[model samples]
Each structure stands twice: as C-alpha cells, then as structure tokens.
Target chain A: SAVISQKPSRDICQRGTSLTIQCQVDSQVTMMFWYRQQPGQSLTLIATANQGSEATYESGFVIDKFPISRPNLTFSTLTVSNMSPEDSSIYLCSVGVGLNTEAFFGQGTRLTVV
Target chain B: GIQVEQSPPDLILQEGANSTLRCNFSDSVNNLQWFHQNPWGQLINLFYIPSGTKQNGRLSATTVATERYSLLYISSSQTTDSGVYFCAVGGNGNQFYFGTGTSLTVIP
Candidate 1:
C-alpha cells in the first residue's frame, strides 16, 4: 500500500493545448498505470508506465497522443497532447504492489477541454 | 481481454439499509479488487479478495474465482457510502479489467 499523489488535481485547458499530469508515489512500485475516466463512465487503461523504458500503450491509445514518462520508480507523468473536448476526462494514476494485491489510485486529475 | 460486469446499474437506499453489489467476470482471474469512487472522483480501494471473504468495517466482499463472480456487502449503509462501486479483475499479468460500476445513493 503506497500513497499516490497526483498534480494539477484539476485544470481547464484550451483546445490545442497540452497538459501534463504527474503521479508521485510515496514508495517504489513495480507497476504504475495511467487511466482515463470519462464523465459517468468506467476507467480505461491508457498505458502502463515502465521504468527505464517507454510506456506500453493499450489498444486505441498511442504514445503520440498521450506521451508518458517514468524517469524513476517513484515518479511518472502523462501528457495529453493536442487536447480536444473528447480528451476531457479524469486522468487517474494507480500503483500495484503485489501480483494479487489491490491497486491504489490517486485522487485523479479532472481535465476540461474548452 | 476479460469482461467485467456489475449488477444493478443504479441503487437508492436509505440510511441503515443493507445492499449487495455483484460483479461477474468472463474469464479466470488470479486477483480481484473492489473500489469505491467517491462523489469527488477519488478511487478508494475496498477489498482485494481474489478468493474467500474479506471484511473491513461496515463493508465485506466475497469472491468465488471458480464461479467467476464476487459480491460486496454493505451493512448499515451511510450517506458517505453514496458513490459508484467498481470491481476490477486481473490475471496472469499487471493489467486490470474494470467493471462499469454500480452507482449507489444512500439517502439520509
């Protein structure tokens, strides 16, 4: 169980702009995941941020659109590029401790594109 | 990909009432978790019961991996428990398949 803190808890960004959301864990974790939740919708995995390597993007998600960076084990950031209204969603960060252990999530970043 | 399904898309309850949230998965799973998404959108982990039963305070969860289903029981429900409950299942790797969630509203 690690505490995950996410930055820019909320933001109102203009279209065509880009916003980077950061996830910082209190302890080192083996798996750090980024997810997007649309209004009144379920959470969808955007990508799995890997340490010392590029993020593994899920189907229908691309690194060019949502570039992720994990400089170390405790810190990772996901950038939403060329924002649009469709990209407006609550971006969440989740951390996994063990194979069968529960995953902890941050408060989430609520992004609004206008 | 694993399909996670949650029952009773919406629920309304009075304070002190009891309710059950059901989650059914399409495939085998080694790990299962339950989370509560509060009014402001913070995901709070409730349980990690892959199998057997686990209890915490007023809430408890039972997962039968063989049956591919899990149940979350809320006793003496409070207004604070009003929110969406999500059940996610993970297997073989680090990916978690999340259910659409059951939205509950407990009126005072």
Candidate 2:
C-alpha cells in the first residue's frame, strides 16, 4: 500500500483566481494521476503526470486550465488556473505501484470557488 | 476507454444488515479495486481483486474478469460503513476508470 498526502484539505478561492494543490507520496512512483469530483458527482480524470515528461490530459480538460507538474517521483502539483464556480470541486491525487497493482489516493483537496 | 457502471446507486441499509454492491465493466481488465470514500473524502482501499475472491474482516470482494463484473459484499454493516463505494478498473495501461459509485447509508 502507498501513502499519499495532499495539501490544503479545504479552501475557498475567489473567482478568476488560481490555486495549486500539492501531492506527496511516501515512495517514488512513475506516474501520478489527478482527478476532479464535482459536487454530487463521480470522479473524473483530469490528467496523468509523468516525471520528466509532459502530462497527459483527458478530454474536456486542458493544461491551461489545469497544469500539472511532476518534479520527481514522490511529488506533484496540480494548478487550477482562472477558477470559476464550475471549477469548484474536490481534487485528488493517485498513484499505483504497478500497472496491475492496487492504486492509492490522497485525502483530496476540496476547492470552493466563490 | 472502458466504461464502468455500478448498480444500486443509492442504498439504505440498517445496522447489522448485509448488502452487496456490483460493478460491471465493458471490456476486459487486468486490475480491479474497491474503495470506500468516507464523508471526509478519504478513499480507503478495500480490495484489489482482479480475478478472484478475497475477504477482510467484514468486507469481501469477488472479481470475475471473464464475466466482466465484480461483487463487493459487506456483512453486519455498521454506521461507519455509510459512505460512497467506488470500483475502478484498468486495462493494460496505468489509467484506471472509476465507476459511478454506490452511496451507502447505514442507519443505526
């Protein structure tokens, strides 16, 4: 099992502002995933951050909106740029030891745009 | 992308009751896991069964990869069991898709 810690458990940001959420893992991982969970909705994959390379984002999400930085195997950050009311959601970070192994998640950063 | 669906989106169970949650995937998968997200939004790993049955104290899960479905069983449910349960499936890649999730409410 992997242990993941995400910063800013909850935050309220003004519209048009930007906020960065940090994710730290207990061990080094090759890939880190970011997800968004809107109010009363299921989780949606935002992007996959790979160290030493660009992040792979899912459809309906872009780097300009949610840029990711994977500085190393144990740390990554997801920035929500120019936030809006619709962007208010819980952002989570995930990592897996292997492709076929069980994945672990952070406690998640709850961002509320006001 | 593999589509994942979960049945009984919302469940209300009495304390000490037993319940079963199902997860169905559209394609074959090499990884299947069940998670319980508490009210505080912490996802707790429950099982990592990809093709067999596994048990833990009061929780158990069975994944029939060939059948493209998995079942999670909770026996003698407690109030602490009230939360959203999600099943995530992955194919050959590291990308895992999550199900719609089952919101369980265990009343005392």
DockQ of each: 0.72, 0.74
Query: Which 10 consecutive residues of model 2 chain B have the lowest summed lDDT?
Result: B88-97
lDDT of each: 0.94, 0.92
TM-score of 2: 0.97
Please, what are the lDDT tens digits per residue for candidate 2 over residues A6-102?
9989999999999999999999887789999999888888999989999999999999999999999999999999999999999999998777788
Residue-wise lDDT of candidate 1 within B1-108, one digit each (tens)?
899999989999999999999999999998899999999898888998989999999999999999999999999999999999999998865678899999999999
Would you give me the overall lDDT of model 1?
Answer: 0.94
Per-residue lDDT of model 2, residues B9-31, tens digit only: 99999999999999999999999
Supply candidate 1's per-residue lDDT for B96: 82
Q: On residues A1-114, what C-alpha lDDT tens digit does candidate 1 reach at each position?
A: 799999999999999999999999999999999999999999999999999999999899999999999999899999999999999999999988765577889999999999
Work out the TM-score per prediction.
0.97, 0.97
Q: Give the lDDT of residue B82 in candidate 2.
A: 96
